[model samples]
Target: MSASPAVKALGWRTPLLVIIAGCTIALLNFGVRSGFGLFLEPISIANGWGREVFAFGIAIQTVLWGFGQPFAGAIADRYGSARVLAVGALLYAAGVALTAYAATPLMLNLTLGVLLGMGLAGTSFTVALAAIARMVSPERRSWALGLGTAAGSMGQFLMVPLSQGFIAAWGWQFALLLLSLFALAIIPLSSALAGKAPEGTGPKQSMGEALKEAGNQKSYWLLISGFFVCGFHVSFIQTHLPAYIVDRGLDPQTGAWALALVGLANVVGSYTAGVLGGKRSKKYLLSFIYAARAVVIAVFVMMPMTQVSVLIFAFCMGLLWLSTVPLTSGLVAQIFGPRYMATLFGIVFFSHQVGGFLGVWLGGRLFDASGSYDVVWWISTGLAIFAAIVHWPIDERPLVRVAPAAVAAE
Candidate 1:
């Protein structure tokens, strides 16, 4: 089919605007989630709760977010991303507000764990990425996705420290209230994705069919397993890395900067992965990325402690961090097509959350019991190697389906 004049006329402006909107939404969505780690020590100290209590809440939030992701993605796939994001913004705002008022662990868990997690599922990458993936052409899809994910990382980098400053200057509750207000900014950006899906392009199969299809695929299982490692590493690091640093006799600010640098470097890494993934073998690249992570973690653990060394480790690790997102999402698009992209990706994301729950919750449990995060770091390093191996054998190809229309059509 010939390109329409309108499609030709879109130039870079439309995609740029869409990408900007996607990045903005992602920044706000994941950024707040990333900052939740900062509240652990302060909140526990103030409320007279044990560290594990608040950690459990955040861990529950991670699992709930994963559980809610596919549903949110299905909603975005069926309805549109804007509606999902708009609703998510409100839900997120409410959750944060309620969390500020939480006096009991149950209240905290309900507000932060369930509400905020569900809110993020709606507004974060699952929705924003699916929206942008649909808007761009295949060749540019990875690039655009990388850009959006990078923006999310940038948000984490910029906002984590900002969150710390907020806590330092104003107290945790007031800081959360301010962050909640900042999250409201996503409402306006949500409009950019309204009515963006191409006409007549949607899920070819019902959710049941898609689930059955994915369930039967070996590659799908591999992808899910690999992604679970990604979640485990990320949640473990984000939730506990700062405290680990403090325990190591380093300043908490050092951990904060380590995270920020990871965010900053990921912007470059994610974008590069997207660009390179378009040209190279995405599965192979994903495998290599995971393998590299294992290597980096090993080196970091063995190296003597210094601020300079830690910063370098953070930068190298950051590059491999979210680089998986673009490749994984791109592979889903390649395998299943965009019609069921969001829903399929959401299922994969669910596995990731399961891992996230273990990572966050177990890290806390182990720390309280053993007085160390060493075992978790070793576990994370091992999982990275396993993830790399899992992706290596995945057949990156489309599934054959029985034609639904007419037999002769095939």
Candidate 2:
């Protein structure tokens, strides 16, 4: 069908609107997740719980977030990002409110684990990026994905200090309440993602089919394995960096600054990565990034534990942070097609969260048992190197060719 005159005139506007909505969603979901570290000390201390108890909540959150993601993505793919996001905002708000009052481990687990994790599944980058991918042309999708992820980092940059200040001024519960309000803000922004269907379309693939397809792909397994390493590295650092700094006799504020700096620097790194990934082999770029992280960690650990060294490490490490996301997601779209991008990507992300659960939970447990994080840090460094090696030979082309059989089956 020919374009309507009104639609033709607003050519660039549609893509721009989607990109803006994508970035907004990214910022809101990630900004809050990024600040989870700040609540660790305060919440645990207030409740007189062991660090592992709170870590358990975070671990539960990670695993459940992974578990819930594909279903959320399927819902978004089937219904629309708006409806999924609206529901996520409501769940996130309720979870945060309940978290503020959580006195028992079971309560913390329910609030942070089931509720908040599922909320993230619905409203987080997977759904937003899929929506943006569908809206943009193939050529621009990589860079567009990068911008969306960068926006998430920018959220981290904005929210870390904001969270810290809230904790200082009002208290942890109040701070959580403030963030809950921010989560609700996604409601209005979600309207920007609303749109009618394109002309006559065949039935969409069911979520079960997408999951089954992903399960059968060799490349998908590779992606999931590599992403596991990413989750382990990222969650370990984000969840424990503050405590690590405090344990090392540095001021707690420095840890917050380190996290914020990482977020600030990641904005640039993610954008540059996106642009580069579009032009070059995204798989190789991701490998190089993972390798760079290992080198950075080794150097950081070898250096004297001083303020300047920590900051330098944080900045260098931040540049490598989330650079994998664009390449990984791009690979998923490349191999699986965007028809079920969110659901497939959600399956891949599930591996990441599994690793995240292990990373955060083990970080706390090992610290309590051994009184040190050396083993976990070294283990993370090794996994990064292993992941870099694993990504070296990934064929970027589509894994399963859609032949007549596939089309008819669909």
Candidate 3:
């Protein structure tokens, strides 16, 4: 699909601007969310609640984010991403601010779980990536997606430390308030993504048609299945890794640094994946990433517990973390075209968040029961292997409707 007339009117500079704005949104959205793990201990201790109470709130957030994504994406696909992002920003800020005052589990669930989740659905990767996909040319699309993902990584890296420092300097309540301000920044930035998807030279299909076509594709199902593993792995680590590290008799700062290291290393990993995805088989690349994740987990668990090893594990996992995002999103665009990229990818992301819910919730349950994260860690490793195998057979060819006439005929 071609970019909207208004987008084209701005000429070459438009693409660059869109990328910049998309990256900023991604950074703020992911950065703020990634640091939630840092708050788990403080919130639980303050409220005299069990870890499950806080974990369940985050779990609800993940599931609602998934459930809300398709609707948010559909709205963005029909209206404009700008509107979706603006609403998301408002809700996100409100949710974060209210979370600071939440004394009960139900309050936390409504504010952090439901409202924040819905806000994330509107403002995060699905919306931003789709907008960027439409703004750039086909050849550069993967790179653009990678840049956007890396920007999110940059946010995670920068924000994690900042979050910890905030909590240390002030209090968890003030830290949440400060982050709400960051969420509010998304409102003005959303303006940059205004307008509909760029029109394609070929006849456009309705959203229903796109949905039906994706439902019938084996590759799409495979992508959904594989992405679930990514969600599980990332959510579990992001929500529990800090505590897991602390449980191992290390300082809380060690966990923060580990997460920051993951973010830092992922910047390189995500960008490289984007660059490589353009030139290589994205499916194979995804397969390799999942496989490598299994290996990393295996090694980390086997080695002796030490600060050096933990940081190393974080760095290695970081390399594999979020590396799948650009490739997976690019695959959806490559197969279905960018016209319905957000909606299609949002459906895929829904599966990711399902895994996220289980990952985060289960970590808390298993830890509370067994007093260790070992079982969940093993489960993550196994899921990674399963994901690796599933991604192997996905068809990467463009859809028939998007194919050239001669190619379609052939």
User: 1-410 in candidate 2: lDDT tens per residue?
Assistant: 56555345446547678789889889988998898898999999999987898888999989988998888887777777888888988998788778998999999999977899888887889888988887666788889989999999999999998999999899999999999998888888887676422321334455576677778767678888999999998898999998888889998889998999899999999999989989999889988999999999888878878899889988998899988888899889877678788888888899999999999999999988998988998898999999998887776886544555668888
Error of 2 at 370 (Å): 1.2
For all candidates, what are the clash counts?
Answer: 0, 0, 3
Which whole-number lDDT from 0 to 100 does residue 363 have in model 3?
Answer: 97
* lDDT (10s digit) by residue, model 1, range 66-87: 9999998888888878888998
List candidate 1 stretches off by more than 4 Å: 1-13, 199-204, 400-402, 405-410
Model 3: pairs clashing at backbone N, Cα or C within 3 Å: 2-199, 3-198, 4-198
Better of 2 and 3 by TM-score: 3
> Please, what is the TM-score per model?
0.94, 0.93, 0.96
How close to the true structure is residue 269 of candidate 2, measured as C-alpha lDDT? 91
Where does candidate 1 have its weakest 10-residue lDDT segment?
195-204
Per lDDT, the best of the predicted structures is 3
Query: Considering only N, C-alpha and C atoms within 3 Å, which residue pairs clash in candidate 1?
Result: none
